[model samples]
Target chain A: MNIHLTDQPIDVAAVLASVQDEGAGAVNTFIGTVRNQSTGRRVVRLDYEAYDAMAVHQMRRVAEQAREKWPMLCQVAIIHRKGRLEIGDVAVVVAVSTPHRADSFAACQYIIDTIKQVVPIWKKEEYEDGSVWVAAHP
Target chain B: MKLKIALFGIAKEIVGSSQLELEAPERQSVADLIAQLRAQYPALNALTSFAVAVNSEYAPEDYCLRENDEIALIPPVSGG
Candidate 1:
């Protein structure tokens, strides 16, 4: 189980290594970082929160779905950061390895997409003037 | 029955607490819980949408909540 939710910065190299396999021909990785601006606001930092137990459970579910869809996938690693993060800080990483290149790419993308939709995690954007929970309002 | 609703992100800020205690009937559904909560914390109604989770899984509107079941008010998630 490579899924993790930590307050510390994500170890991208470790995540990539977690999916290493001799038979795997491709390892695909998706890294999400905090941006300097959002919707034209100069973002200062982001505060992330999560329902710890449920977030991990949802991430695992997403991983399982990806594996079921791409049986050739050898391994999967998903890591999400919590607490405060500055611009350019890594927020999440999804790495996948497979016997071929296509499955690895597809599974990695699928895992991140599903995690965003289903995972019980939230991020608040802070600007110089005010802050808001991203996507909290229509 | 007594229910403790866990709040997160904006929901927590609106309620000014991470957890809340509510007194409800034994047969309260998820929808009933939401209505009660929104009335108590009107700011929650302003959010685009929210979800209810029972014991860590998303619960349907009509899902009946039981005692000792973990319940949470989930604001719109923005994780990447």
Candidate 2:
């Protein structure tokens, strides 16, 4: 398992490579990208921040949970990027390999969903007028 | 006891610092710490919700805190 919270661009290829396994017959991946618009507003960019130590710790727990929930999973890798990101840039990536496709897909989904809920990371959506922290308010 | 709590995301922004120090009586729960924080930083009360992490793990409201426990204020997470 590999988990990271980085200020630099996320290398999806590297994440996929880290999950490669000869015993694994299937690999599932999820890439989260910064979109051009948010909630009907035009987004210029996004600024992401994280409590690095705790974020990484929570990510590891996500991977662990996936492993426990899916025994067939061979490996898991998650990378989340921080700092300013333009539209279309990758913000996060989750890759999972397993002996079969079903387990890979399930584990990958779980990792991302859990990360969204528990990871100590935040993103500020920058619009032409101003900015707002995503999910900071109802 | 004086405990230092790490702040993240909007919590850091609202407090205007990355970390804060607060005074807590012995065997204080996470709830007490949050109450103190909300009193000092009223802006925290307006957030959707937040969690308290003790020693890098999300702790229950009743979890007792200790000195140098590395507590963190986890504002609503938005990561993927």
Candidate 3:
């Protein structure tokens, strides 16, 4: 399990490569991007802020849960960002590897959805006019 | 007996402080501290939608608590 918070975009290929193992037959990844529009408004940029300690901790918890659910899950990698982001910027990444495809897919989705619902990271939506903070990933 | 607890996010901002020491029965869970915090910090009362974690791990509503644990009060998420 790996969880990190950096201002830099996560290297999806690197994450996938690191988790590759001969024993695993399947790998699934979920990448979240900055959407161009929201609530009928065109977004100019986005700023993500996190209680880093708690956010990383929450990501680890998600990995642990996936491991418990499927012991065959070989590895799990979770990366998120904190700071200003523009459209197409990578906001979050989740990857899971297992011996079978089904378990990997199920576990990957569970991890992403759970992190959104439970984690405490907040975002400031920067529009052309102004910005506001609100609960997202519900 | 009582224990020391730490707050974060909007809770810390509302309290105008980072941590607080409150009196509670021994072996109280995270929920207990939250109750006291809500009573003492009126600003936090308005934010009923919150989350908690103990020692950086997400704590469910029924999660048990301990003394000196770094309990975090997390506001709603605004992430991707």
Q: Evaluated with lDDT, which candidate comes out highest?
A: 1
Better of 2 and 3 by DockQ: 2
* Candidate 3 error regions (>4 Å): A136-138, B1-32, B39-43, B46-48, B59-67
Off by over 4 Å in 2: none
- CAPRI quality of model 2: high
Q: Write the per-residue lDDT of candidate 1 for residues B5-74, one digit (tens) a residue.
A: 8999999999999999999999899999999988988988999999999988999999999889999999
Look at candidate 2 and tell me the lDDT of residue B77: 89
Residue range B1-80, candidate 2, lDDT tens digits = 88998887889989999989988898899988889889988999999998999988889999999997988898998977
Q: Using Cα atoms with residue i matched to residue i, what is each candidate's TM-score against the true structure?
A: 0.97, 0.96, 0.79
Runs with alpha carbons beyond 4 Å of true place in candidate 1: none
lDDT of each: 0.93, 0.90, 0.79
lDDT of 3 by residue, B11-74 (tens): 6657777776767787777677677777777766666477677778768777777766777777
A1-138: candidate 2 lDDT, tens digit per residue? 888888888888889999999999999999999999988999999999988888898899889988889988888899999999999999999999999998888888888888999888899999999999999977
Ranking by lDDT: 1, 2, 3
Clash-forming residue pairs, model 2: none
Clashes per candidate (backbone, < 3 Å)? 0, 0, 0
Provide DockQ values for all models, in the order shown.
0.87, 0.85, 0.42
Which of 2 and 3 is ahead in TM-score? 2
Which pairs, if any, clash in model 3?
none
